[model samples]
Target chain A: MTARYLALYLPSLATDRIRRAEPGLPRSLPLATWEPFGNRRVLTAVDSAAADVGLRPGQALADAQAIAPDLLLRPADPAGDARALHALALWARRYTPLTAADPPDGLLLDITGCAHLLGGEAALLRDALVRLRQVGITTRGAVAGAAATGAALARARGDNPVVVSGIEAGVVAPLLLGPALRLPQAMLAELARLGLRRVHDLLGQPRGPLARRFGQDLLGRLDGVVGRRRVSIQPAIPPPDLAAIQDLLEPIITRTGIDAVLDRLLEDLCAGLRQAGLGARQITLTAWRVDGAVQEVAIGTGLAMRDPAHLRRLFAERLERLEPDLGFERMALEARATEPMAVAVQPSLAVGGRRDEAAMAVALAQLLDRLGQRLPVHRVAPVASHWPEHAVTAQDPHDVDPTVPPGWAAQPRPVLLLRRPAPLEVVIPLPDGPPSLLRLQGLAHRLHRVEGPLRLEPEWWRNRPNRFRRDYYQVELASGVRLWVCRTGLPGAPRWLLHGHLP
Target chain B: MPSAAPDVPLDQAAVLAALRARVTRLEGFGRAQHNLGAVPVCEGLPLPGGGLARAAVHEVLATTPGCGAAFCAVLLARTGGTILWIATGRDELMAWPPGLARCGLAPASLVIVRAERWPDALWAMEEALRCPAVTGALLALAPPPGGGKLDLTATRRLQLAAEAGGALGLVLRPDAACADHTAAVTRWRIGSLGAGHGLDDPRWQLELLRVRGGRPGGPWAVTWRAATGRLDLDKEATATGATRHAAG
Candidate 1:
């Protein structure tokens, strides 16, 4: 049996995504994706407006500026472009399950026997192109007999497809060798010097000399392009481990209806998770609106949990934030991240302190979830260090136990530690004594009493050169304010800084 | 303020006392329960139920601006578990992690929340107080404009929330006169006495201006010993004060 493949190339995937996201932007403006290349910035991708104005990819930003002063440049997001390509691949799964992403901006699909369902190869190609256009991406695609690489080359060359099989070479021969073969600039220059600009020019030469000069890569590519070699497309695996979808007969606009659907979906998902002995750490709810927009809300659990009630509560808080304007016709609940849940919690006779502690942990987790909605919530964990700032670290609440630090009572530390020591202008007695007055943020505080200069220096072996050597003092102002000040640098040119306060 | 007639019978008085006891118990005031348990503030400073109530609102007023925040931090450090510190300025509380550690609070045990206005700060505090995991919630509020949201109504909501969640709610108001009517169960005026001679402890004059259902005492000089989590009272100076007590 013969194979069939289709390759779609989106040259300006980054700019296309930007255009789709901001449809209000003027399309006539010359927009291009700029990327840092070596010591200079180069155009990585260009929109049709920029392309029409004769700006090409890999052109230096300075050179482009000389050509078109009105050229609008946006920093290219390569990662985001890749993600968009992957999403397109996923969307293509509606046509065929065999879809793979060709990075930077391309997708490959093994349409094989699936084209007939979409009314033959031409209809399928038209459907794909039309859908991509609706999504704001300009695409070029081709369907070839059995060569995946040939279809890719055909798309890249912007040529009609070789759909009739056995004519791959005929279709590829007349195309310029530089673009059709995707060769290096030096090789293309040499080929041009030899008056061999087209594939047909190279095809007329004897194989022996071509192998000796251009090496085996050219022959391999040629073989792959002409169906002599079978090049398979590796499809990306989809994630649907624990997901439930609900379709409504009519659009649901009310909160109650959405909540009901979410409740049913969560129950369905948790039932599957329970049967599989797994718990979800991250859950995402996507609402497919009637207006073709997708509204999504996501929540995470500190502990691996399969309890439907808890999951519903977490989603409930987030659901209020998701405004499904114009209503939604379908909703999907997916557990993006999951882990094995504890089979059973030990049952105590009276539900004693251990139970209370467990309940407290759960309460804290819920509080964290709610608090994190408005602002970030972090857990403070003690680190083994003598430097004040290095003594503790803020970590994700899920990763650390929110318990009191051990041996915290013995320390003589300030109530509030500054993220960094702030500088304080001081009126020192000058010959190495304590300051008589200190000024912070332009507020003068006369030092009524002064404590010792507790000289603390960074560990010499642990730290690099220019390690801080500070003489700390506890100073009290006449207005009854106590401050922690430090004197650093050499005694001849010492700088005074306020470190903290002892309330 | 007791308006009972002098001619009241003994049996009637006994019935009245019994009824009041029942009402107090039903209202959750008869129990010797403190919200976050209590910090060991020096002796002679009488605290009802042997310590401060856990599920109640307490106000700390700084006699001077920029003075009471440290005191509030010290009180918060004494309460174990995670603390939610909400203030108007985002960066205002960022500098407190290390200093909070020195004051016996696990430096990392706090979640700092920045709100743009007093109302938002008050709302965040109330919400935080209702979270059981948040054993303590402290709000450092700049004095609100008169008749603003930081009145009896707002503090009352905070009080109810703290009580419901069994968490302590502390409001630190610097550079503001105390409101005549507030829902706070206790109010303390804090003034710094400054640090002592070389190697001496930091001192503060704590005045227990008002306390609901208990005696208001102090204006007492207390030295906070950082090495050990305890408050040392200046016994000789405190002896001159006339004792005043009120029955709850």
Candidate 2:
């Protein structure tokens, strides 16, 4: 049995309200639609009357009005049109997952496997048309083996829907003519003069002559229409299952209402997460305004969480930061799973259980949210070194090994540590002993009980050159105030400085 | 000198009591589990048992360029489990050593967000701190206008958020001076030390100007070996020993 390929097109279908409202405008009245421009407006669509009167898009509004004094102009709302198209796309999804929008006014659905469910190709087309007409949408549909052929036939052919059987190469080869073939007007006129008006007339001609006269693109388009070439269509990204949405009968204005709606959306989002047996560590909530602008609030968690109340509270903290404007019509919550969480299980009672790390992480996250990034304590690990500055480092509490040794247990270290030891002039009362009187930062301090100097040397294998040596000392003043002081270079190197003190 | 009587080991009950007391003291030192090690803005700090200081803010202010701001930032960032490094204007303000990664900071976990302006950077820092999921510390360069002093109210708000979030915030103030209004728990000045002799280690000096629960002022000499960016105290005896033996 010979196979038959069919492509269905829906033109003038008014998949969008803007296109449906087009025929309603008085034919004699000059009408134009304005679209949004940055902080202003620009013309988008112009009616035949308006075009006849010399009004075009991109012209200043005042100039357009002056050109067509009696023009009936309305502001174009692309967002509303997009929403309507999206709704139509959703509706078309029932027919085929391959359904997509052509933007502004068109939708394409590849109903390869779905036509039989609607009682064959003809019945499916009829059903679609009837459903659209019931919604006050004017539509025209055509079926062919090729997309381009179907689109052309739907646009140029009569209201009687066109249905072509067989593949494009065999069936649509003879039917292409006039604008359906998409040959330029001058080319079509020349073809008509040459007595080759129909695509069939040129099909039998030699390829060399066709290429010599017309461009390769024309032949390519013909090949595309005849299914000899492949075409790729960009599909929309699929939405995740964990989605939260709010539908309001009336637009919400006050912040309180917005908060309530957001809370409800979070609850739904949490429900979705629970249904998927997942938790969200990151969530973005979008407040879609009636004015078409969307305000988004995003929150990230330290650990995966699925609790609705916790999620709601996190969003509430962020919502307090937003200034709602022009009211919102819908609230959407998009939750993305971070790290996979383990399945929840009841704890066994045999062993003494410790606090859950996840709970602690959540508690810490809450603390971080309220405390401004400065409170969660982390341990500073000491590097094995003699230099006071290079010995210790800070690390996050979570990153720190609980089993690691404490910072102070290793050595009797100074209370105060300097970032870098400063150069100071010290007069040693006894040549090798501790300085009796030390001059540091323009101040003289009398030494009392002095400890031995602890020296630190630089690593030689490093690429950078080392210039000095340090000798750190723990000295007690007459008043019993202990200080951690250091001198740079060896004992005879001539440079000694006061580095830091023990607090 | 007369030595004390022979050391005696405490019984199990006494040891348990001592352990309890020590735990109590540690907890008391930091009322909030999150705020331990936080230095205060002023001096005369109350010392907890085991030499631990009470919970207070620690401010590290550096007047020199290209010091240990990055090291301190890495330290501060770890407080929140993760860290958000908000950089504005300058990129190389903080120098993070590789040793910090081994010290408990996961370098990959550090979120470095570059902002266009200081205020925006501050705002991002504030937001990151407010995010519970971030579970990270906030490290931001102080605003250019405040000298070394951040807005008290802003700092207070951040402190409150850090308290609430249990995240530590460390502000790297390059070339910042000590100001009376600055609300940082402890203010410190850190700088790079002169390189040591041949086959020696790199040295650094840190000055604590204001410590909340500890004493401030005076400098501490530290050595940073390139092999392990870890910091060590540069003691006088070590210097004398190295000189005597000609081996460091």
Candidate 3:
């Protein structure tokens, strides 16, 4: 298939970059950016207001200041201009995936086979130019069969599309050779000195002489213009395989309007995912504002999901956070990360109702997604340890347990383990026996019945050795409350603390 | 609330039929006694539908320190399905995994939701209770210092959420006076009655303080029977102030 390309030229990019950053700057004032060249300062760029006053770029800064005494001048920022231009190119990916920055104020889009989504090619170019205009930028663009011809035409016949095919020669025969092919300034000057201004002048000449004179550069550019050689551009973004984009007829300013657009985009995106038998694990919603700014919000799910309703619910929680200043004209939804719908899950526990394990896992996942959105939800997995506090750890709800989990100790343990042990003032009637009474925080608790000390030695395999073996006593208070108290230190230097409570 | 049982003799078949009708009306058609699926507390205690009501909030207040958590563990185990144990804020009385395992609760089936604040905890509980995938939700809310109080509106919201999803809702507080205005289907005060005559099995005093639709019973002594994973109720052990002398 013959490639189609759209060249977007921003003639006033430098001045607009300054104005876009400080939007409140008066457009009535003539603006110019100046740069220091050795010992002299020269004007690098001038806005339309400054141009109207006959203040042109490349003129001495003092001369321009004299011509337009009210000219507003700022330091030239070439680096910032290139970065913003690249960002604009990345934003253009919403129109077509193959987009690249055509530096010093231009962008190129490989919109081949992508025109049908927004009607024919003509409508697409018109839509893009109008959207750029809304962002306070006046740009010119053109679409043609060849990237070389399209970029040259965008400069000369802005906003027009080359409608016919195989007439690339007829179209270029009338135009100057400098634009018909992207020749260097030196070559164009030399050709002009020889009185060869129009492409028609070169058409009658042999290819050997021009190839020798321009060192194959002129011939290669000529071949690219007439679609003889297929040249490639490095796209700013690789583009997502699955995405849905909407170019609004009128800028959407209200939440309801944005929501309606999102509904359509999600429907189309989810349908594509379902058709591919894949689900979106993470998705990004990008909104291109009329003021040339883009905002994006992302949502991630616990499991790969293609359910439009669920996705919509997740986005609804976050959409309110977006700032839709001056309204947005274009929106794109992309599945940034995806996975096959059948991700494996361990069906360790039986969920109630007459559903299979797979179906139960799906239900549980959805439930977890909904609950987890507002709060943290997790389960305890038994860690391989003998210490009661370190025996179990909090993990994701769906974490699979070992096929054969560690066996429980022969003796009973507390149901609730305190993160920190609570100290108790013990009054032991017997030196080697359980405490007769326990005092905690000025409250007195007398024991009703006591069980013997169950000695638990610390795991010596650990780097830190346990200095004292824990002597645990399951004692019942007179109120019939069970407490698991531990004598943590040696008998001579005993430190008593309540470790856990039994149900 | 010592209301009398029906004077008319209940034949075996007639009682079974009555139970089936009640279960069908409360839950749906053909659901066994396992599914408006109440906590299977041993008989003699006055629980709505012969056990603590499911799909409705039940307040389990600890008159004694550890008794409430013990009773809640048993309820969480027998009430059925995926359980969510929520500890509101930092002053939570979380049941350790090993201890709850002793009560027959499989750690695999339980989810522990830890919230940073009281409102968040209630919100989490309501969300869990509303999901049909969760069969039971237990919120451990401490009073005053670290935890916030659950007003009538909060409990009502939780009750409505539980009703919508058909999951058992349990709220364990530290005291009987914790919530003056409660919308719970039943209010149970659990206290320890000491180790039963020194056999290593500790007995708890289960008092049915209030019931919405059913008459209140119990102040009954029940021991945790590990082998059966159920409470063993002692018919003759319903004495009040039994621990008063031992308190000194």
Candidate 4:
């Protein structure tokens, strides 16, 4: 029931990103990335070499160049860094399903029940760091009882890697109030002016005075760090396991040009599924637009399948709905759900003239799949209920169900049943006989012949309200149009409604 | 036994005439087979075959709902393959499963496609006709709420698609659509005959308004036998404003 979190902070993300991308960059050389801040260019990130030369982030680039004259320089890519951080967060889903992107350069993962898989909390953190290091990304990680404290320890405390509660006070004693605590810089400056720079100084102060001075935000965050309050992290939805993503060099703006690229992605995804001996029952194509909006089109099959050609045909029907406004920058084809499937073996004897019976069946399934994606494709299945409203349902054409029979109620049901029954006006010929004329929808119909008043009652155990018990009639007008009408209530008091029309 | 590349142009006039004949044969497959290998329409229509062509488009201008959906349901049962009932939102009043079963369409053999627009409905019908598994595709073609009519070219495309896949295509449009020029092999206008009190057998005052190869004649009061699920032209059946005119 305990919540434990791990925060992974990439300190030199911008500089390290350039180094990792271009391995020829000398790591031993001092390096830093700078970006425009207000009017002047300031350092946004510094590598270990640059830090050792007494250079730091936020320092004027001219001053940093003066301090380490031979420093390697590159422009800071804030957007790319943010994207990489988000991707890393998604990649971290391997350790835990719950992971969030802490922007600027950090990630938070709720490794609660997931810690034991890689041995324990300490071993998991070590494995994570080692793996990211192999990818050439320097990462600092700390696991704590709270996300706030874990974030503070990983980015600001710089001490233990695994700090469960109770030991958090002694560990957090000397740590200064920093950006990771998410405190306003103005408030931190005010506290530092009162000589209360360390977390321990504020921890020992009177809660009432602090509340009066700084409002409740400072106390709420401090309690959150000490494990007194639990704050839940908004984790990103986990990406599908079996998927292929391609970032385009040029955004795709035309539907005509989409097929060549889609075919490649489907091939890649189907290959992965085939290797795992599984087939996708449900798959989705997610197009990330250049304008930062995402459009998703998904298809489902009656049976598990790994055929790229068949899937491509189905996707083509719906791809028209995916608007490439300003074009799509990246796309991913993912199998949202899969099922174990036997590997398909090619029949050695290939003969072709006309399509065979087996091929016809496949064609039928494919047709349903394609049509079902763009519109409502279903078979009308009979439900075993005496109630007219409960007698039928729209069912998927390919779904095999055991409950429904091919036919129900040997009595002829109407060919067209109105979704809502309309009230009918009846003028009976005699006191006991059926109606001779009727008015419906402002049209007066003279009855030519009237069939039986077949009485149907609700189930024995059910509450048979007056309207629930009905006397149904198949009536024919002089114009030869047939209608199914029902009369409820006793002979003394009758209510009529037009139910449906006969073919 | 000659190659499909057509006889070499020996005489320019002869070659041109031969190609014209070939084009007519290809273009009007339905007219060529209007008298042979047709799906029998119960008690023969006024046509020579007493039936309609199998792999061709037939338009029915339903004066009362033009053709009853029940008639199409019976055709689906007789075709003995996967059937598609394509309808737009306004015209999707059929497909009551038990009612379909009552009329003879197998429950497992039917799939309904609801199209949001008129073009999509036409596209779905064309797509269904092209699929080998679909033996029949019936489209309930109501005039789109926004004004758009089915043109001759669209009907021709459907005809070609039907010929390729060996599937039957039936289109039921409102009687108001009778003025549109269509490439269909036959166009029938069916009006509900106001008859006696007995409505068990829906009788229609049917008129074969047009046909490609045959003279169109009807206004024959035909009865749909519920028990046999067949169309019967009964002379003794009482009908209002119906003529017994017949043709072949």
Candidate 5:
């Protein structure tokens, strides 16, 4: 399929990010953000006020300081800027889910089939820029019949934001080669020395000499800018497996109204799943607020389910946490991570068809869904290992395979395992004798009986090169409490640790 | 008042009276009308069917750090399914896998959740008790420095949730003062009775502080063997050992 793209460039993204975050900052102030470069600080971004004072980005801080001494400086946050751009990409999902953040200051969107959704490409670009400006972000956008690279370059350099269909070469020919092609500074300087500055000059020249002189990068970038090569965008989030969208004429703020809308959306989503004979394990509900903000809540079940009431109840637990601005005018429910529904066992009067087990399983799933709000749930399954600590592991409870039996260790382990072995103060009679008294948590206990120091060596190949040997002993205290303690290090100077207990 | 009942037979009247007595005896909401064989330890309790009853809330008080955790964990191990363990305070103080295994519970069958606040821990415990997948839930809540006393209403909600889900709920409270006002079906004060004569027999001083619809007379000398996952009455040992013993 032929790809059409839209590239949005935020020219003042860094300053705009700062301004957006600190809305109270005076616009008249000459603001410049600098970042550390090697041993020096360089201006990474500048506001219009700073630019008017002859300050440019990438200039050394000392040079910029000499020019505008009153410039308000801030440390540049590249990560924060990238996050802001990514957030804008999510906001753009309302127009098209095919959106990607072009790091630092840009967003590349695939608008091939989505243009008509927002009237047209021209209208979409204008509306998008207007919305961004309203959010204090100054933006430049361009649409092209070719790939995202062509639109991105045009937005950065070309006077026209919209390139006419099928006139890619004509539109790209007039732009300066320096801005159009992303080449090394040395190579651009070399091209400038050769009096080759504009795209037309490079186009009119022999292709062989240019390719030989600059290697293939200059030609490759030129090919990309003219639609000869495709440049695709990798979206931040994968599109939902199935989605149900609802547009409301009037926004709803009341809990009952929002819940009703969500209930209807869940029913619609369940209907789709029923038709496909698939159930979703994870469900996400998004509420698009009237103030151009998106609020989303997600829930996951240990088992696949399409029951609308059950899904609604799970969402009901989370609904109070979602604070909508004013109210939400649109809502979307998406089903992700779907699996085939397990065929329900028909209840028989004779055998009972394992009805009790099935009911119990269902009830457990419901309980997990309710408890999922405060904490995550995991299934504990025994693993095939001799080491007491490594004998069992946590698994997703939904992945229940009845044929695979749990593997139990040969040795008996303690009832409660400490997160880590805690040291116990014990008094040993001599170099090799068992401890007569153990002190733990400011209390002393008389050791009643002694057990063998069942020595277990470390799996040196799997762990650190030098590891200590473990000598485990099950000791009974005079208070009737049984504890599992272990000795580590050499036989002569071993440290005792209370590892487990028989509670 | 006599005009409407004049035609009733004497035998029918006697039968009705017997049924009413049975209903009154089984009035506790958490008392198991069925599935009595599911948990054996409850049989020692005064509840109907000679058991502690499934789908009920039980309170265990532990004066020491490790004792209550061990007792509740062993009891939960008796139930065959996932156990949700909600721990309050600095959760680092709670026991992990090997200790749980020694208590006869498979480490894989236990889910540990740490709630920093005691109230959050209680809420999570109630939520977990309402989940059918959780066969049993144990919450270890130390009395908060400020407002940590758990009243009857909070426990009643947990009781209802446990009954609804047919799951047993156990609360490990470190506060002994709030024991009498609890809404739990049974409240037991458990402390270490020290070591027994054998390898697996660990004795505990179990004092049944309160029991609804039954006699509560513990502070009994009982030996708990992890292998059998049951509490054995130590008849030879006198209950006098629990005289100085105290648990929350």
Candidate 6:
């Protein structure tokens, strides 16, 4: 036997007045609505009474009021309407796994093999409508062999849910109305002018002429509704593993209780991961409150981890942000994109060396998470320059250059290096050369021994016009203290400053 | 703070113990020799025999504003782990050492912690080192001290924390006078060697005045080649001469 699929369509579900009825206001009330405008109002919707009195949407609210003084008015709320539609869609998920929202106020359910459980297609439709009405939502459902057929049948006629099955889609294609074709109003008008007012009228024409006259869009819509074309629903988010949910017998608000529940959930999630031979790098914990609101907290790890203890520790830090307002009734934990851990094979004796790099990386990641990147550790290298300040640069620790030679500082260099060599007021005994007396840091010191007139010309290409030529000298103060100073200009020139000193 | 009574010997012991404990903790359940692959940089030190300084804290004092303080900090940080560069005093003077990229220290691993004042900068540096999970290095540029009592007890406490956490600490003292007493295990003065002819690289002369277990007074000249970002020892450049001066 061939398998059968049923497409269930819900329509007229998103109207605001029909939705806002507390017990949802009686559907019989004359509901007129308006939205805010600059010192004016624009009408949004009208109930059966107001519609009968010619109070259509987009009419002025003042004119609407003048025409019907007793009209019950309410503001249009698109967000609230969307939320209600979303909730209804979730509720519809009980009937099938492929249920999706049609937006504004409709739901599409691909009840492929689920109809027989509720008796038959008709019975399923009736059961769904009945449940919706009981929840204060007046709904209409149509079940057809295909989604387009069901949508067309549900919107074309107000008759009880249509159940068309077993026939080829083309045979019943003519019965669908113009609006059921789901085309824009202008295109519909053009089709109407061409005398192709309904699906049957459009389908009877030659394919080549129809495509030439009304365009492929009209033909495409016709083909789509009759099952000649395929349409796929793109889900907002991909489904995750272990969609486990706990419905509380009572609400829970305490942090300890929430943490306990989380612990249990994490264990279950970990068990699911282990069973699948995988680990999760990120986990999201959601708390569903009694008032139909949900709060979610997500924690991500540096590496894929399956340990429940570590997962718990990560989540514990974020628990304070998940306040259980009005008490939480349900908790859910989901693991996404599980993959097997990449285990490394032991190396042979021929390739002997330390294997601590990975461990160090993991430790570094943990430290980064805790400290938030405040460590000033980095790799340093000597920059090419005669100027002391430009001689070296700092790099990151993780980026240690393997190519650079080590232990290259065994020659004579000042242990106490200055960032910028400072100038000094020096009193030289002779006509040229190193200073004998120097005044620096507001103190006078006698120079005992001095070395170098290491002159470095400024980097002319750096775009700085007034760059100085420095002459550096390593001077030993009278107290056995060594200092690194630089003289600007020539050996006999006046510009000089004391830059750095040894410790 | 009377210079903390010059507890160099006690400080060394405490510092070494702290470093050993940190290395052990970082190594976790594995034996020191077994986990030798974990910290390749510190692997040069033998296990169970002071594997690595728990958290080695040293001071680099320079007279000039733009000396190679940041460069030394970067080296220490890259070798140690994560690095935090705390810049105090003038903004222009405090910068990342050049050629840092060639050394493997990227911007992501090097964190520049900015502070307006010296004391605050020191405090911030201490706090950064206290985090155990950080397992990195802390480098700060301090202002010139006005008195002889440069007892950084709070800094010592922070160093202890860093040791416990398995990190290294380096404090860059800028524009401070050279004194007879110091709390650091190693103290060095870096300056420029004599200029070379055209096409020859600039040579840097480093004088190791005070080292915990190493000889002092020998000047180490290193030639910094800009194009390659590498430091080379210039063995030909000998120390000029030492004119001994009597201590006051």
The recovered share of true contacts, given per candidate in order, is: 0.51, 0.01, 0.67, 0.61, 0.50, 0.11
DockQ ranking, best first: 3, 5, 4, 1, 6, 2
Worst 10 residues of 6 chain A by lDDT: A344-353
Clashes of 5: 29
How do the candidates score on chain B by TM-score? 0.78, 0.63, 0.80, 0.77, 0.80, 0.62
In terms of lDDT, the poorest run of 10 residues in model 2 chain A is A343-352
Give the C-alpha miss distance for residue B248 in model 4, angstroms.
Answer: 19
Predicted complex 5: CAPRI docking category:
acceptable
**Please, what are the lDDT tens digits per residue for candidate 3 over residues A1-503?**
76788888888998988887888888899999999998999999999899998988789999999998989999999999998898898778777889999877788899989988879888899888887887667788888777766776776564466545567666766677765565777888999998889877877779998888778877777777666777788898667768998989899999999899999999999999989989898888999887777788888787888889988987887899778877988899999889887644323333444235555566667777766766778887877777776677888776756332557533677777667888889899978778999997798989887886888888777767555688899988776678889998876889998888765
Better of 2 and 3 by TM-score: 3
Question: What does candidate 5's lDDT look like per residue over A273-383, in tens digits?
Answer: 989878888998888776666778999887788889888878877898788768887888989679887754112222465776676667667666666666655556655
Could you give candidate 6's per-residue lDDT for residues A9-101 as a string of tens digits? Answer: 443333432544554565565676679787789886665567888888778999998887877777887677777766655555445545666
Q: What's chain A's TM-score in each predicted model?
A: 0.63, 0.49, 0.64, 0.57, 0.84, 0.58
Query: A261, model 5: CA deviation in Å?
Result: 6.1
The whole-model C-alpha lDDT of candidate 6 against the native structure comes to 0.58
The positional error of residue A468 in candidate 6, measured at the CA in angstroms, is: 19
Candidate 6 segments exceeding 4 Å error: A1-66, A70-179, A186-213, A241-251, A286-296, A316-323, A335-340, A344-357, A369-503, B1-52, B56-135, B139-161, B170-248
Candidates 1 and 5 compared by DockQ, better number = 5
- How are the candidates ranked when ordered by lDDT, highest leading? 3, 4, 5, 1, 6, 2
Question: C-alpha displacement of B228 in model 3, angstroms?
Answer: 4.8
User: How far is A363's C-alpha from truth in model 2 (Å)?
Assistant: 7.8
Regions of candidate 2 where Cα sits further than 4 Å from its true position: A1-46, A50-99, A103-105, A109-245, A252-260, A278-355, A359-503, B1-29, B32-55, B67-148, B158-171, B174-178, B189-208, B213-248
* C-alpha RMSD values across all candidates: 7.8, 13.6, 8.2, 12.9, 5.1, 11.9
Q: What shift in Å separates residue B78 of candidate 3 from its native position after superposition?
A: 1.9
**Which is the leading candidate under lDDT?**
3
| B-chain TM-score, candidate 5 | 0.80
The better-scoring model by TM-score among 3 and 5 is: 5
Ranked candidates (TM-score, high to low): 5, 1, 3, 4, 6, 2
